[model samples]
Target: MLRLLFVGDVYGKPGRRVLAAQLPLLRPDFDFIVVNGENAAGGYGLNRESFDLITGAGADAVTLGNHAWHHKDITALLNDPRLIRPLNLPPGTPGRGAHTFEVSGVRLTVVNLLGRVFMDAAHNPFLAMDELLAQPDLGTVFVDFHAEATSEKAALAWYLDGRVAAVIGTHTHVATADSRILPNGTAFQTDAGFTGPLHSIIGADPDGPIQKFVTERPHRFSVKDGPAELNGVKLELEGGQAVRIERYHYEEGGDGSAAS
Candidate 1:
């Protein structure tokens, strides 16, 4: 059996903190780790330094979303062949959208995608996912459908039932309680949550966002620096079937967000 761990979106420094603190504890149990780094760069884009940090933190591969290009050189960085983008990108896009990994003789394939409705123009995720689903030599598969709507996430999970091991949603920092195994043997969740500040608002400074909202004034967004907590999902899959799905939240000392 191959164990797959998918981390929620990493917002900023706070997200980075818990990520670094928990990997050593989780390394022995998870063979492959995937993290969403789109928001790791000052809460907007994934910078080169952040990318290196995510990899250094035990991420076998990193996935990106709509905010992927927030950094300057991400276009060139995506060419390194290590990072993956949305599979539904228009023809001739730079980075790969999907790839396969080998772990303990189990072929694990991971695909990243962006949503349509209520999002920037991207290829149809459903069509893009179907294309990858047709590929062969597939043992276990994981889909990071970075999206904005919960309905979209759920619809995609149902569409991929019995074909892939898991269909996990990202992009939203808020954690959802819908993690479960589908009737068709696939694990699914609306969102894995985020690995960042607990005291702040939605992974940001609670006061900062609150001020911006209450005062109706433009406030410079900054990373919420407080207790950091790591959040994500751990899954066990064998022969393309998911046997278990779990959500994990870890904090640093007393500063991190309490587990729900």
Candidate 2:
């Protein structure tokens, strides 16, 4: 079986810290690793330094979301084969939406796609996926559907069932409990969750979000400090099908106590 670990969005410095600390302990058990790092730079967008840190921590590929281009300087970094952006972006956009890697002698393709509901304008993800699948020799496939609505994520998972090995949602930052193998052997999870501050508002300082919610006004937010967690899912695939999927969560306290 080909074992793959998909980590959710890395919020900021805290996320990067926990990832660097935990991944080494977790890497030996998996054949390949993929991380969602759109917010790795400063809870906004990725940068060269953040990319290096993630890959140095054992990530084979880093997937991005709507914030993929938040850092204008990242355009050049996008050319790296290890980075993946949303496939539904306008044509001629720099960076690829999917990349393939050889893991344990098997070809594995990792795809990143953005959802349309309540999100920035982009090409239709469904049709974009159709075009992607039409290409030759995809081998075993995995998709990081960075989207907001759970319904949209589920719909795409069901639509692509039996075609892709797994579909794990991102962007929401909150972990979902509904992880299961679909009728056709594909693994599906509504969201993989974020890897960052566990006691804050989705990896950000709670005060800013709370203020914004209460006053209905913009408030500056910063990455939360203190305790953090690493969230992801582990998938086992065989014969181009998902055989099993399990959620992986590890939390570390401010005083250094850790839990799994």
TM-scores for the candidates:
0.93, 0.98
For candidate 1, write residues 51-95 as lDDT tens digits.
888888899888999988778888887875558778888899888
What's model 1's lDDT at 95? 84
Candidate topping TM-score: 2
List the global CA lDDT of all models: 0.84, 0.93
C-alpha lDDT of residue 8 in model 2: 98
Candidate 2 lDDT at 115 equals: 94
The sequence of per-residue lDDT tens digits that candidate 2 reaches over residues 1-260 is: 99999999998988999999988888999999999998899898899999999999999999999998899778999999899999998889998999888887898999999998999987998899899999888889999999999999999999999999999999999999999999999999999999998888988899999999999999999898888898999999998899999999989976756875
For model 1, the superposed segments whose C-alpha errors exceed 4 Å read: 215-218, 255-260
TM-score of 2: 0.98
